[model samples]
Target: MSVIAVLALDGVPGPQLSAPGLAFATAARHHHPVAYEVRICAGPGFRSTGGPAPFGIDTPWGLEGLDDADTVLLPGHEGFRAVPPPGVVDALRGVVERGGRVGAVGTGTFTLAATGLLDGRRAATSRRHTRELARSYPRIDVDPEGSAVADGPFHSAAGVLGGVDLCLHLITQDHGEVVAIETERQLFLHLHAEAEDTGGTTSGAGPTSGAGREAAHSALADADREAAHGALAEAAYNAVTPPGSSLEPVTRWMEANLHRPLTLDDIAGRAGLGVRSLTRRFRAETGLTPLQYLLRTRLQSAQRLLERTDDPVERIAARTGLGTPANLRHHFQRSTGTSPTTYRTAFRAVVSGMTWPERPDGRP
Candidate 1:
């Protein structure tokens, strides 16, 4: 099993600390053999900054837990822009030095960057903070548009829901697609329903409908959430499509021919291989069958059109080969957790130099 140590610091956001645990636990619930052992560790004086109420939180482990961890996760906290607590940076550095993977969600990227491990590395943070992160850490290649980024063993995610994307990504890295997809279903459906029953909401909406589902989805339409979903989509694509893979030509062809109704035989013919052989090779190379990759590419293309142009959803869907507006909305919401209209609104606001309302947390 992979041992994951989550570093809880003073003023750490509660969701960031718990999302990974929930993801790993969901994986354990669905998988035959448990895949992860998650430990929440903290130095002394740890307190949660945002919750129903201000409260103290204590963990069973301390900084020492990181020493034996296979992965260490840092969740965004109130003090992200401030210097980290003593020993925090060193412990994070030690995890990477000892061959353990390290990742950050949202503003937690600021904490990881403080350790200097991100120097000369491409990292990501909340889109709103990208400029600040770039200015603060000149050595790090901060991707403002990235939802999640993985450079070797270092991973970073942007926004609040980004923790889910990050953890799901880590699960995907550790296990194959089948296990990760099952885990996601459990986490977003069963576990989310249970959470809603208790009058609580998960950081991101689950896949199923339940109490507060509409409200949660509404909340996810903000600028931060839109960025998070885009980043997640990008990260998922990157995870499957590595550099210089054999599937590159096929994928490029799919992108280029998205306006046409594509069939497996059509793809196979283009690749000069039998259908079965093409299917096997495509799955091996991209973790998805050719059809799945084509669908995702179509959705991504529609999203770009939504963001960049005033095209109607029907037109965008037809242009991306999705066939109809209703089909586009169905797949778009299922994949991105938001509607095309809502996504376009948020994206357009940013592009038009319009300022967003202050977040509930009061950050700009």
Candidate 2:
């Protein structure tokens, strides 16, 4: 099992501190074999801001607990601008030096940035603090628009629920997409039900149930059994024949023919269905119309080309069937918030240790 140490400091926000533990616990409740061992660790005098009401928390582990952790996480806190206590920075640096991953959520990125581990790396923090973070840490690349960003082994997330996103991403990296999706479904359902019961909105708030608190343990053993049984039954059915929507083959064809100037009628004919039937089923299965999927695929192809090759904008637009450089620029910027040239320049700078050049057209 992977050991995750959540470093709780004085004035740490309650939601951010507990979100990772809840997420990992939810995953353990669904997986057959438990995957994570999560611990809340802190040094002396550790307390939580408790939102508007201040409170104190006692943990079983201290800074020593982080020594053997596979991952160390720092959650947002009130003292984000204040330097960490003596030895805290050293402990964080030690984790990275020993090949362990480090992550932060919201203002916690400020703490991580203060350690200098994120210098020269892209990081995401709460948008509200973006300007202050950038001003404070001139070397760290702060991306205000990013909800979550992973640069090498260092990860950062924005907002309160951003911790859940970060945890889900980590779970996906450790397990597979299937496990991550299942875990997310179970957790979201639990949170949603809790919200409805309390007459609260089902926003990306942290979990608030006893089950949620004990998620990393055996609290949901029965639910895990039922989920496992259901999965086994599904797998048995899948063994007899492949499972998925009829649109699967059509979607695959679309991926293969992204460079072609395809239309809805062509897709419908290829799927052997009338346009209306094709549209309904495609939306049901893929959550997108055929044309939307096509556009998204082309944009993804264009992004890959920009990242991997030095292809000019017009050539890439032609190759991806985007038609013209201006069209590609409009759509690409709408989708990614950066032009092709700027995106390519930033990506190359990161991957190849190249410096970003000044372009007369104001591209990065």
Candidate 3:
């Protein structure tokens, strides 16, 4: 079972902390035996606004509690500055270096960014703070339209209420779509409005933050412009699939070995199938050739890093096994049809509701 620790700080809105805990608890209770152990780790002095009614709970652990966790969650708080407490920042950095999943809820993203773990990563916090976040962390790509954004092991949300969406996403990632969807149904979120909407403005289309959420939504529309408007309905449907970890052994192996430069022969030998048979089965199951799937998978990881972290292009290339920054630029352009810098800028502007100059049209 995973040990999930939520880092609680003073000033966090009551719902921001409770939402994820409640959602994760619901997910844990589905089985006869729970799949995770969850706790709240209090940082600094334990005090919360709104008194005992909303912020009444006491924490069982302290900052040191994160050391024993497989995942660490930071809930949203108000009054964040360009800099956060050194202890809080340092603790979060350690958690990520250890390869533990570290997530932030709503304005909690400010704390995560202060840790420097998300320096260049794409992330979102409460829409109310999007401008300040972008101004403070110019390198980080802030996605407004994204209710919740996941990059590598770091997850972030745009509002306190969005914590529910973030939990659902993680549940879907850890388990399967069927399990997550069932959980959502029980929670009365019968559909993921963003995933199901055509015009992108369905009933639940805008976030609870209203104008702030709308700004982010506008950015999302621009980011997805190439999809031919409402044509995205079909594509979004196709994009929804079971979690990657639950697939067959060979597929799981591919996911595990992504950091290595692998060939068809390497995968086939491990899967105990001939090259031809493996190719046939893979195509039948995933509808893509082995090489195509590998490329897509690698690109997906690269995109997440581009969105979530400040790692240099060279480092991202090496980690994703594309060989060099040049290789990354080449393939990234071909796949996404935009340079990483432009992608980041567009995303930030949308989330911040700012306008940027047009790209050079090669005029004399």
Candidate 4:
């Protein structure tokens, strides 16, 4: 298990302090292999009985608590304009020196910037502070439009709810794309407050603050969007297979490792079969050759990322094992008879109840 220490300086923003633990727990719940010991550390004189975890720490660990942490998170606070205490800055730097990551959210970027760790690095902070942060730290590159920025081991979030995006990015780095999607789905299901006054006009990340990029919305109801999500996910990675199928294990493994350059022999080695037999059996069961299925899987992954995320095509291509943007575009246009951008736009409309036009050959 890894340790994630959240150091709360004086005047800690309540939401920023709590969001990381929430995102971590939700990720763990969705994917059992992910486990983290979250420590909510605070400055001296901090004490709590019922804190984030069930067994609250009687004396919240101070900067010393970060010594064993794999990731030390800092939340924005009231005194963000003032430089962090010397001890706090030293503790944060120590975590980086030992090769751990450090993340800050909202105005917390200001606090981290003061440590000089952000010098010559790009950072994201609250929109209002973008100019000030740039002016204050002349060496740092402040991204005014980005929701999150990761430079080396340092990550920073721009808006208050950008914490969700930052945490999701970390989860993706630690686990994989599929796990991050599942965790985002879990968070979406648990988000309750829609709108009390406007009959549901919530407006965080397309009306779901916890949605991040995976659960980004269409013009559908929550249930409908979830159904669409399930359908897409099932098609992309989890087509139904009969019990005791010979290729079940290999197919599951293929879905998990779509980002890898998998050939028939490599997959056959995993399934303990010869190349010919693996190809013959997989094609018989799935109606596509082993290589064909692999390409299809990669394209599906690309499509999911394109539709549900704000990530650039180049990043999506890399994540989906399409290798490069040019390669992804080549395969995507050939397979769908439309460019990736066109597919994303048309499919989102389809999910919103718009019927897709028939193909040139009159096929659906």
Candidate 5:
């Protein structure tokens, strides 16, 4: 069996630590025993700090626990007030050197990046830390807009809850697209299973939903968190298309032609429906008109490109069908409350480092 080790820091989030084991464990049971063997390596002790629960527990193994694992995960934790302990950094470095997969959830990416493992690699963390990341780690390409990032053997996720999305993506990469989809369908049980499957959540602080999650996150409120993140994953999955609807064909066409300038008439013709009928059905099923949905998806793609690539805003505007850079910037600022350049500079994770100009407001 391939071993999967979860490395938990002293103040790691509880849900973040549990997420990998739950997802992978469930997957292994439906598949095979040889599929995975998961273990929690508490560095030196099993402890909860800055998590849902508070208490330190003991572990059977220390950093050596990761020595031969197939995958090593670092769940999200509070950022360091000082340099990482020597043992933690050494253990993480060893895992990568031995060809084991390495992953971090949320601010845990800081630990991995600090180890210099992510130097010049594409990585991601929660959006709140985006600018701090760019200013702190200059060489690493931190993808603020991405939910998950796989650079070589290092797999990094946005935040605590993003652990689930990252794990699902990892399964797809390790197994196949079919298995990944099945796992996603199962993971949706927490929210609205059997509603629709959009796919996964984007990168940021753990999702903003659920009483337990909010209470656990002293930084955010419970009601606000649940409402914000409650629909996101479902939206991602259901955004695929409603079953038994003629709109599926049109949806696929739109996704395929995101770079093309599309009009409602063009979409209606492709779906073999009139403009009025298409609009009505699209709204009834997807809760979005074809144009509205198209704009949102295009914006998402544009955001990703801005963070992960060196391509200019003008070029990204053309690819995402947003037309001119000026128009793209206007919409981007309106939607995300930040400029494209600022967004790109903050969330991109780097090991080598880059220079970030000080904001007039003095943010990263």
Candidate 6:
């Protein structure tokens, strides 16, 4: 198993402290996923100051814990606006020199920057801090739009919640999209599971009707839930919304019915518009014509299936409406520069890694 050492400084945000471990632990629960040992390594004065009632955190390890870590994560501290201690900076640089990776959350990027390792690398922090980070380290490219930014051995997140995004990205880099998406699926499942345990509340809506279902969908959307939420989420969403719901968006209908032989007229009819009007509206919103959007949706669905299943190419063809194996291969090759089989083979376990586990086939 790989060790993930979180170097917690004083006043580290509560969410940032826990999110990376939650993501890594969930990833370990999924099929053939990487096993990780997450350790909280803090200094003598370390404590939580980001919440209303601050509390001291006791851990078994210290900065020395970072020495054997596969990845060292730095969560933002109250004093991040100033320089980090020389010991901390030297320990971080040593990790990189030894070929391990380091990531920072929110203002914690400033702490990582102090080591001078991110001097010319692209990094991300919250939008409010982008200007400051750019001015402080002019050679670093500060991107505010990405959920997370990775440059060589360094990684950074935009906000507290973005620690989850950064950990997911690092998981993808160390493992593959297969494990990353599965990790996301587990996280979202946990949210819904919490909701269900609390009596299936739909925020005052009655437990039974179109109004209730609509509220549920809205909640999912608020959670940033997408098809990436995996099969359980898709099934639950479909159970509520279904096809032909008066309030259902046309694009959503397209997503649910990717297995169908849909056409321009089919899509336009869902939106109660003519094909021409549908084309214009879709182009304006998604930068793709209705048919073009459908095509992209089909290919996206195919990609997900390719990543998540053992179903053969012929069945994948029918499922994505690509029609036949040859047609699917042609489009897959055109879009991805590879065949579906080859794509799956490569995506399944890229291992492709900082002291990660050996391949399933037991290669070094």
- Which candidate leads in lDDT? 1
Q: Model 4, range 1-364, lDDT digits (tens) per residue?
A: 8898988776665666678888888776444346778888875433332223322244358788999999988877767898686688888889999999998888889989999999989998888889998999899999987576889999987744537777877777787655565455445434532221211111212212343323322212232333343433223321222345688788778777765555566778999998789867865555444665566566756766655566667677666666556667766664445566665554544332312233352212
Please give me the total number of clashing residue pairs in predicted model 2: 2
Q: Residue 9 in model 3: shift from native, Å?
A: 0.7
Each prediction's total of clashing residue pairs, residues at least 3 apart in sequence or on different chains, is 1, 2, 9, 0, 27, 0
- lDDT scores of the candidates, listed in order: 0.68, 0.67, 0.60, 0.65, 0.63, 0.67
Model 3: pairs clashing at backbone N, Cα or C within 3 Å: 120-309, 120-310, 121-307, 121-308, 121-309, 122-307, 122-308, 144-216, 145-216
Report the Cα RMSD per candidate.
13.5, 17.7, 17.6, 14.6, 16.7, 18.6
Q: Write down the TM-score for model 4.
A: 0.55
Candidate 3 local lDDT, 1-364, one digit each (tens): 8888887777767766666666776665432123677787777754773334655567668889999788888877655663665488778878888988888877788888877788778998878878888998888899876567888889987754537777777776776554454344334322122121111111122221456445433433332342333232212121112344223676656655665656667767887888788767655544444555555555655655555556666676666655455556655565555555555444433322211122242100
TM-score of each predicted structure versus truth = 0.53, 0.54, 0.51, 0.55, 0.51, 0.55
Among all windows of 10 consecutive residues in model 6, the one with the lowest summed lDDT is: 193-202
lDDT score of residue 90 within candidate 4: 86
Residue-wise lDDT of candidate 1 within 43-144, one digit each (tens)?
556856566565666667999999999999998877889888889988888888888899898889998898888999999998899999999999999987
What residue runs in model 4 are displaced by over 4 Å at the alpha carbon? Answer: 44-59, 159-162, 193-249, 252-364
| CA displacement after TM-score superposition, residue 211 of candidate 4 (Å) | 41
Clashing pairs in 1: 147-231
Q: How would you encode candidate 6's per-residue C-alpha lDDT over 35-141 as one tens digit per residue?
A: 79999998436766566677777788999999989999988888888878658988999999999999988888999998899998999887788999899989899
- Predicted structure 3, TM vs. truth: 0.51
The TM-score of candidate 2 is 0.54
For model 2, residues 1-364, the per-residue Cα lDDT tens digits are 8999998878777777678888898777545434699998874457655466776766779999999999998887777798887778999999988999988888889989988889999998888999899999999989987466889889887854638877877877776554564455445435532211111112221122355324312312322343344443222110000135566687767766655556677788999999899867755554455565566556656765665567777777766766556667756665445566766655544422211232342212
Model 6, which residues run further than 4 Å from truth? 160-162, 193-364
